[model samples]
Target chain A: MIEVNDIHKSFGDSKILKGITTVFDKGKTNLIIGQSGSGKTVFLKTLLGLYTPEQGSIVYDGRNYSDLSSDEKSDLRAEMGMVFQGSALFDSMTIAENVMFPLRMFTKQSKSEMQDRVDLVLKRVNLGDAHKKLPSEASGGMQKRVAIARAIVNKPKYLFCDEPNSGLDPRTATVIDNLIQEITQEYDITTIINTHDMNSVMEIGEKIVFLKDGLKEWEGSNKNIFKTDNEAVTGFVYSSDLFKRVQKMYLEEDL
Target chain B: MSYLHSIGQYFLMIKAMFHKPTKWSVMRHLIFKDIDDLIINSIGIVSFIAFFVGGVVTIQTALNMTNPLIPKTLVGFATRQSVILEFAPTFISIIMAGKVGSFITSSIGTMRVTEQIDALEVMGINAINYLVFPKFVALMLYPFIISIAMFLGILGGMAACVFGGFASLDDYIAGIQLDFIPFHMLYAFVKTFVFAFLLATIPSYHGFFMTGGALEVGKASTTSFVWTSVAIILLNYILTQMMLS
Candidate 1:
């Protein structure tokens, strides 16, 4: 549902992304996995039209999003949702207002109908009674859930999340990962997530794009990531303590 | 300019300015916030005007006196002239440079840095028209009101001198009307209008370029205040030469 063709981005002399290209498919969780400052955020921003690529085209569904007019781009964005890294909730607004922001801005729905949609989404995220609470009042995990509720409130056709599980505990990360996976499957929406969290890659990575220093390194699934003989993927996956143990466990079993 | 775009941008800014989910019934109440700030902050502002300017000029003119035929309350003549020409218009612009100009820059700059302005752009809103227009309207309206307040404040300080037995009422009134030109009053009012316009536009310009974050907003606000104050003081000199001279 999203295609990036030879995208190149530069900040003066510093090249952030050097000709990276990838496709994120529909009805699955597409994970862009990389270390911090690995240009994943820049890629996601390029896809969101927050940054203009120095060279390349970004096609969302069928529209040339990299070239659309501002109004047209906004219209395109209206069909999409984003879960920011910080949850980026408007501190001045309550949880309910946060979720209803997209609905009120994009949809012509009346106040009651908007409230109904807001209630439905909050309940869907298992946050029914928590709508009155502020984002500051919620825990990191609950805040992630609130962000999820806000993202899906408009029923967007495509959802982009920049590390929805970044600041959460393992259990909360898993919960958020599962919610993203479940939402992707249920709506058959194209969801692309940028993450450094290895747990997310293993849990919900139906399609994975691995990047190292701005170039696409390996493309694989969680089921076969350990089996891949590629040195880059092996080094990245095993560099983590948990993945190393998983590798050792499998190696001992085979021996 | 496309008619569609103009109307579209107008509505888009209205949307963002009201992006808060709560009901807007408290808009009138927020004006009271502005008043509270003005009343409290304007005390220091008026003191600086009254002491260094109105009071000091009176004492300076008193030092130059040699003619016993000239009223001893010649200081009151200097007081009325400087308060009307210098204090209200020029000093009030300096006050607005800190108060209102800095406020617009910081508020809009904060919105810009947080990507809130981008959110408005993504919503098809003209980030400029939406952010700048209403603030410009408010700045234009409010500083003129403060100018009147400053004018009265100077008169109040003059009353303090009279009550302290510094100058008799008859001598003060005669000295004030001695060379009192109606055109000088007209010139000062005209300059207040110019200062108000400059106060709004300069800071709004500084704010429109904000992108980084809170640090950037603070930078924009400081720049706005400094530049606007300097602009006001310099313009005051030019106008003083052209009109008051």
Candidate 2:
């Protein structure tokens, strides 16, 4: 579990993340949903220590992130995994090599031991036959699966995905979302994903935090989201005609 | 002012390269890979340029000596001086500034645009040390390539002198051995070593710090090539004045 106090971040004279506080629980899919330029990426990067907040504190489990020494921070990083929006697989390496990279960097396992673990993770991601293919040779969905495999191969305590569904088709996006949700449950890892996909918000959003212009606008699960009277949340989530009809049906069913 | 900022940032990057060194096992593979990419692959171009340019210098010197009072061996002597003093080291490095420098900048810039560097940082790796230090070590073997250029350049001069009937092979050999100052060779090598470091680091700094997409990668490569060539020429002038004058 991660607890964020009133953290504030700014770039030059313009503020990006206001004093926002939230909790991302373990063994759950925690989603940060916002429109473009709404500080979702900055907030996620701050939680990952890519950006330092000017105020407040981030406590991972019981340890404060800012209080840890450099070495301690690095050690903490080793226990965390991240899936970038582009997958960010090393173009020069094969899929197997990509998955084996973190293990090679951080583990004492022999080559065979590492290969076995890599194979297991690839299989878990339903990519057993893609061990030798380069990232460029894989499909878009396949690349995302490879990214997920690489992220979770180390059995991290925390997992973060930045716009994991971007550039993917709706069907492929659903697959990636379900995979992340399943992994969060299977490993009981604290998973935080930043996304704008409404489908993802309704599907895997066990704990959702909504942000608008750098402020926390609303917080709720998918079940409670339809019932919320908050104008910003409703306007943002049900902006499409299809979703507006869905909301109407949901409200009618609830009534 | 931007140039000054980039200069300061480049030095800071060099300083950061020594901290949190990557595991030697990983570094070893990276070094070998860079040596193959930056040095071994560059040999063909350097040698081809060196050989043909050396031949042209010999032919030009021989034709210009229309006065019967000048010795035929002077053709060999002039070729030796030109090849060793400037052609093999400085000119070849400028060519490499276009070839190898563009390569480093474009590759690293692509990585930056694609977020590969961020991935490394997220893994707790010092991205500069992981990416740049291996190139530095690989370029340490640069003088070896320059040495080959010097030898092949002189050989090309010999071939041109004999085949073109400008001078006898024996006379050319005598001219090459005539007044051979060992210090001149040392000076040439010192310049080569410095140029090698610039070739590796300047492009790296440009590529690593660049922000943008594919079009900006191309811009960074051109900018790196221009700056690297400018640095090499400026440093060559300073070193020549300090050492020779």
Candidate 3:
């Protein structure tokens, strides 16, 4: 589990994250949802130690992130995995090499050992035949799968993804979301994803933290989100006619 | 004030390159790739430019020697002096600043745009050391390229002198040996080594620190090329004054 305590971050007069305190539990998919410019990315980056908060602390398990020495911090980072919005696969490497990168950097595995682990992960991600293809040759869903394979190859203790569903089609997005949920459960990782996809929030949001203008507006699960009376949460989530109809039907059925 | 900040940042970048070195096995692959990118690939352009420019120097010198008192042998001497002291080192480097400098900036800038650098940092890798140090090591072989340029330049000058009927081959050979100072060659190589360092680092700085998207990558390459060329010319003047004066 990861615990954040009243963390604050600002950039040159524009305060982004404002004292956010939350707990991302292990073996659960935690989602940070917000509109554009709403500090979701900033909050996620802070949790990853990509940005230093001016106040409060982030504790991973029992260790405070700021208290660790630089090398210790690096060692800690080695246990964490991240999937970028754009996949961020090394453009120069084939899919197999890309997945094998973290293993090569951190582990003393022999060549055959690394290749075997890479093959195992590719099979797990349903990319067994994509080892030789470059990232550019893959479809959007395939690239996201490759990114996920690369991230989890080292069996990280935590996983962070930024806008994992941004450019994918609906069917592909749902597949990516379900894959992440399954991985989080299978590996029991503390998975935190930053996204504004309402479908994702409804599907895999085991724990959702909703932010507005740099403050946490509401916190709940996908099941509880349907009953949330918070104006900001309702307004954002049910803004579309289709979702509004779904919420109305859900409330009606409850009655 | 911003310039001062950039200067400070540049020094910091160089210092950071030595810390937390990447594993030598992985680094070995990167270094070899960079050798292919920065050094081996540069030979063709440097040689082509050197040879043709060397021939031009000989022709220009021969044309200006209207007085019979001036020995025709001076055509070879002039070509040697021009190609070795200034043309091969400074001129070719400026051309490389256009060719190689722009390439480094655009490639790294594209990586920045695509968040590849951030990915490296997230993996606990020293991004600067991983990215820039290999280029530095690869450019150490730059002097080898300049050496080839020197040989071909002189060869081209000799060819022009003989074929153009400006001077006999024997007199041209004599002229090449006339008042030859080995220290001049040393001075030219000193310039080459320094220019090589600038070529590697300045473009990297622009690429690594750049902000924005695809359009900005193009802008960064242009800006890096301009700054790199300016820095090279300024440094060449200072080194020439200090060494030759």
Top candidate (TM-score)? 3
Per-residue lDDT over A1-255 for candidate 1, one digit per residue giving the tens place of the 0 to 100 score: 988899999888989889888888999899998777789998888877778898989898888976788568767877777888877676667999889887766677888999999999998888899978887898988888888887788888888898899878999899999999999999889999999888898899989998888888888887777778888888888897889999777778767
True contacts kept of each: 0.16, 0.57, 0.73
lDDT of 3 at B65: 95
**What value does the lDDT take at residue A172 in candidate 2?**
92
Clashing pairs in 2: none
Model 1 lDDT per residue over B1-245, tens place: 65466446445544544453322332343344444543445556555555545555555566567677777667677777777777777876787788778877887677666556665554344556555544544554554554555456446546655665566777666666678788877888878777876776677777876567788888889988987898888888888788766
lDDT of 2 by residue, B25-104 (tens): 88899999999999999999999988988899999999999999998889889999998889888999999999999999
DockQ of each model vs. true complex: 0.23, 0.77, 0.86
Q: List, residue by residue over A46-162, the lDDT tens digit for candidate 3.
A: 988889999999999999999999999999899899999999999999999999999999999999999999999999889999999999999999999999999999999999999
Clashing pairs in 3: none
Best by DockQ: 3
> Which segments of model 2 are wrong by more than 4 Å?
none
How high a TM-score does candidate 2 get? 0.98
lDDT score of model 3? Answer: 0.93
Looking at candidate 3 chain A, the ten consecutive residues that score lowest on lDDT are A41-50
Model 3 in CAPRI terms: which quality? high
